[model samples]
Target: MRILHTADWHIGRRLHGFDLTKEQNHAFEQIEQIALDEHVDGIIMAGDLYDRSMPSEAAVAQLNQMLQQLNLVDKVPLYAISGNHDSAIRLSTGTPWFKSTQFYMYTRLEQAFKPVELPDTQLFLLPYFEPFAAQQYFNDDSLQHLEQAIVPIVAKMKTLFDPNKKHLLVAHFFVAGSATTDSETQLKVGGLAAVPAGLLKDFDYVALGHLHGKNALHAKNARYSGSPLKFSLSETKQEKGVFIVDTEPFKITFKPLTPLKNVQQLTEYFETLEDKDFYKDLQLDNYFGITLKDRKPIPNVMARLREIYPNIIALNRADGYETNVEGSGESGKQIRQKDPIELLSDFYKQVAKDDLSPQQIKWAQEALKIAAKRESK
Candidate 1:
C-alpha cells in the first residue's frame, strides 16, 4: 500500500503578522496533485491540523473546504489527529460523519483501540497525548514520562494488532532523534518531554509530527513530514517535503512539496552599495529579507532597496549600535558619545512629541546601566 505521510499543516498560521491562507491553499493544491499522480492509498496527517486551538472563522472554512476537496472530491482516505495547537474536541467533532467520507480523526485516546486495516497494513493512530490524559486512559499512575506513557498505549494496541499484518503507527510527539528549530513552540515543561525511538520499535513504520522541518528525526522506520509552508524567518532556508511510505515490503521515501513562493534572507553592507553590479545581482522581488550594515545611517534605505527587491519584509542594522546603556560599568572603554538611555528617550520623545520626565529619564538610565553590567559580565 502506498501512503503519503504529511503533518504540521498549521492552517491559519501567520508569518510576521501576515495571513498565510493563500500559501496554505496553494500547498493543498500540491497535495491533491500528489495524490492523483502517485495514486496514494491513504494520506496520513500526523497532527497540528490548525495553527491554534481556537482558529479564526476563515481558517475553519478553509480547513473544511480542504477536507472536502481531498476526501470527497478526490476520494483519498485521510487520517488526522490533533496536536498541541489543536482543540481535541473541536477537531474530533462530526467524527461519525467523517468516517463515512473515509476520513478518520483521532483526538481522544479512550475512544477505541481498533486499528484501521487496509488490504496490506493496519494503522495504529496515536494522537498527541498529555501525561495526565495518558495516565487517566490507562489508569496507571506510573506513567511519568511521555515515552513511558506510550508503553501501555502500545501494549493495548498490540492486543488488536495482527502480528502477521504490516503495522503502521501515526503519532504527534517530540522524538529523541528529531532536531527542533527555534520557531517550533515548546510543548512540554521540564525534562518530561520527548519519547525515545526505542518506544516505537514494534511498529513496522511510524509517521510523526510536531517538528516543522523535514528530516527532523532519524529512525529506521520513523519520520516527520514537516510543515507544508515555511512559518518563520528562521525556516527561510529549510527544504520542506512530505514522506511516502510503501508498506507492501515497508519502505519510506520523501517527496518534495513545492511552495507557491520562496522565502530568502540576505544581508548586505550599505557602504558597499556603490557597486551597481552587486545590487544588480540581487533579485529582491522574491520575498527578500535584507539586513543593511552601515556605520552612517542612509536616509531612505527601505525606498532604495525596494527599487530592487519589492517584497522586503524587514530592515534592520547588524552593527553594534547601542540604544541604551543601563547598568554599564565605568570601564575605560570608549565612552558612548551619546547616552544610550538618552537616545531611547529622545526616540520616544520624538514619536510622542513629549519630553521624558526626570523620573522617566532616571529609570531609563538605570536600566541601561544594568544592561551594560550584564553585557560586561
Candidate 2:
C-alpha cells in the first residue's frame, strides 16, 4: 500500500504581517494534485495543523475545504493528530463525524494507543502531550520527562502493535540529532526535551513532526515532512515537500512542491542592491530579509528599497556595521540625532516590515511630543 506522510501545515500562518492565506491555498492545491497523481491509499499528518491554538474563521474555512476535497470528495483515508500549536479541545470538536468520513484526528492523550488499521499497516497515532499531563493520565509519578513519559506508552503499544504487519508511528516530538529552524515552536523544557532515537527504532516507518526540517533526525526509518512552505528566513534553504512511502519493502521518496512565494535573504551594499542587473533573473516579489554592509546610515534606506523590494521583511546591518539607536555609526553616543518621532517610525518600519497605518503614525507623533515636553522640563 502506498501512503503519503505530511505535517506542519501551519495553515493561516503569516510572515512579518503579510497574510499567507493565498500561498497556503496554493500549496494545498499542489498537495491535492500529488495525492491524486500518486494514488495513495492513505495520508498521515503528524501534527501542527494550525499555526496557533486559536485560528481565524478564514483559517477554519481553509482546513474545512481541504478536508472535504480530500476525505469526502477524493475518498482518501487521513490520519491526523494535534501538535503543541493546536488546541486539542478545539480540534476534537467534531470527532464522531470526522471519523465516519475517514478523517481520523487524535488530539487527546487517551487516544494515543488506538491504531488506524490500513490494509497493510497499523498506523499508531500519538499526539503531543505535556509531561505533567502524561504523568497524571498514566498515574505514573515516575514520568518526569517526555522520553520517560513516552517510554511506557510505547511499551504498551508494543503489545498491541502487530509484528506481522507493517507498523507506522505518527507522532509529534523532538527526536535526538534533529535539526531545527526558527519557525518551529519550542515544546519541551529542561533536560528531558528530546526523545532518544532508539525509542522508535523498531517501527517500520516513523512519520514525525514539530521539527520543521525533513531528514532532520537520525533514526532507522523516521522522517519529518517539515512545513510545506518556508515560515522563517532560516528555513529558506530547506526543500519543503511531502514523503510518499510504499509499505511492502518499506520505501520512501520526496515529491517537491513549488511555493507561491519564496522566503529569502539578500546581503549586499546599497549600490549593489540598487543595480537592477544584480537580481535580474531572480524573482523580486518574494519575501526578503535584507542586510546592508554600508558603514554609514543611508537616508530613507528602507523607503528606497521598498520601492523595488515591496515584500522586504527586515532591514539589518551586516557584520561590523552595527549602529546606535540614533542611527549613528558609533556606539555609546546619546540618542539625539533623530527626534523621538523619526526614531519610532524607523523602528516600526524595520520591525513590522511594513508601513505603519495612519493611526499608528498619529500615536507616535503625539507620544513623541509628550516626551519632548517632558525633556524640556
Candidate 3:
C-alpha cells in the first residue's frame, strides 16, 4: 500500500495581514494532482488541520470543500488527526460516519489504540494529546511528563503490532530532537512536550507532524511530513511537500509542492530598494522579510516600499536603530528585536562556542521566567 503522508495544513493561516486563501488553494491543487498522478492507496494527514482551535466559519467551509474533493470526488481513503491547534471535540463531529467513506479521523487519545487494519499495513492514528490526558487514560498518576506518559502508550501499541503487516504510527508532537520554527506555538507544559525518538523504533514508519519542516527530525524509522505551506519567514528555504510511503518494501519519498507565493527575504539599503530596476522581475507578491542596512531612517520609507513590495511580513534594521514600535510600522514584527531565544542562542554560541541545543533552549527559557518572577517580587 502506497499512502501519501501530509500534515500541518493550517488551513486558515494568514501571512502578515494577507489572507492566504489563494496561496493555500494553489497548494491543494498540487496535492490533488500528486494524488491523481501517483494513484496513492491512501492519504495520511498527521495533524493541525486548522490554523486555530476554533476556526472561522469560512475556514471550516473551505476544509469541508477540500475534504469533499479529495475523499468524495477522487475516491481516496483519508486518515487524519487533530493537532494542538485543533479542538478534538469539535473535530470529532461526523467521525463516526467518516469511516463509511474510508475517511479515518482520530482526535481522542483512546481512539489511538484501535488500528486501521489494511491489506499490507496497520495504521495507529494518534492525535495530539495532553500529558495529563495520557496519565488519566492509563490510570498512572506517576506519568507526569510527555516522555513518561508516552512510555506506556508505546509499550501498549507495540503489543498490538503484527509481524504479518507493516505498522505506521501517525502522531503529532514535538519529537525531542526535532527543530522548530517561530510559527509553531510551544505546547510547553500540558501537551506532548517532547517525545524521545527511541520510544518509536518498533513501528515500521512513524509519520509525525507539529514541526513545519519535514527534515526537522532525522530518525531512521520516523519522518515528519511537515507543513504544506510556509507559515513563517524562517521557513523560506524549506521545500514543502507530501511523503509517498510504501508499506510492502517500506520506502518513503518526498515529492515537492510549489506554493503560489513563496516566503522570501531581501537585505538591501534604502536607496537600492527604491530603485525600480532592482525590484523589477522579482516575485513581489511573495511574502518577504526585508532587512535594512541604512544607518538613518528614511522619511516615509515604509509607505514608499509598500508600493513595490506589498507582501512584506517582517522588516528589520541590521544597524540596531530601534523603532518606536516593534510591529506597528508598515509590517508586523517590524524592526525585529532580539528576543530571549535569539539572545540566549547568541550567548550560547559565544560561551559554549557551539549552537544551543533544543534542551538548552528549554532550560534558558525556564531560567529566564524564574529570573523575571524573582525581579518582580
Report backbone clashes per prediction.
11, 0, 0
lDDT head-to-head 1 vs 3, winner: 3
Which runs in model 3 stand beyond 4 Å of their true positions?
184-191, 322-377
Local lDDT at 45 for model 1? 93
Question: Can you tell me which runs of candidate 1 are displaced by over 4 Å?
Answer: 185-192, 271-283, 303-307, 322-377
Q: Write the per-residue lDDT of candidate 1 for residues 18-114, one digit (tens) a residue.
A: 6678889988888888878899988999999998899999999999999898999999999888887889989988987888877999998764376
What's the true lDDT of residue 84 in model 2? 81
Residue-by-residue lDDT tens digits, candidate 3, 134-225: 88999989988878888999898888888898899999988888876655444333255788899998898999988888888889889888
Candidate 2 vs 3: which has more TM-score: 2
Listed per candidate, the RMSD to the true structure in angstroms reads 7.0, 5.6, 13.6
- Clashes, model 1: 11
* lDDT of each residue in 237-303, candidate 2, tens digit only: 8998999988787789899989888999999998998898997877889998999988765768899
What are the lDDT scores of the predictions, listed in order?
A: 0.79, 0.84, 0.86
Report how far off residue 172 is in candidate 3 (Å).
0.2
Clashing pairs in 2: none
Ranking by lDDT: 3, 2, 1
Runs with alpha carbons beyond 4 Å of true place in candidate 2 = 183-192, 320-373
| TM-scores for every predicted model | 0.81, 0.86, 0.83
Mark the 10 consecutive residues where model 2 has the least summed lDDT.
183-192
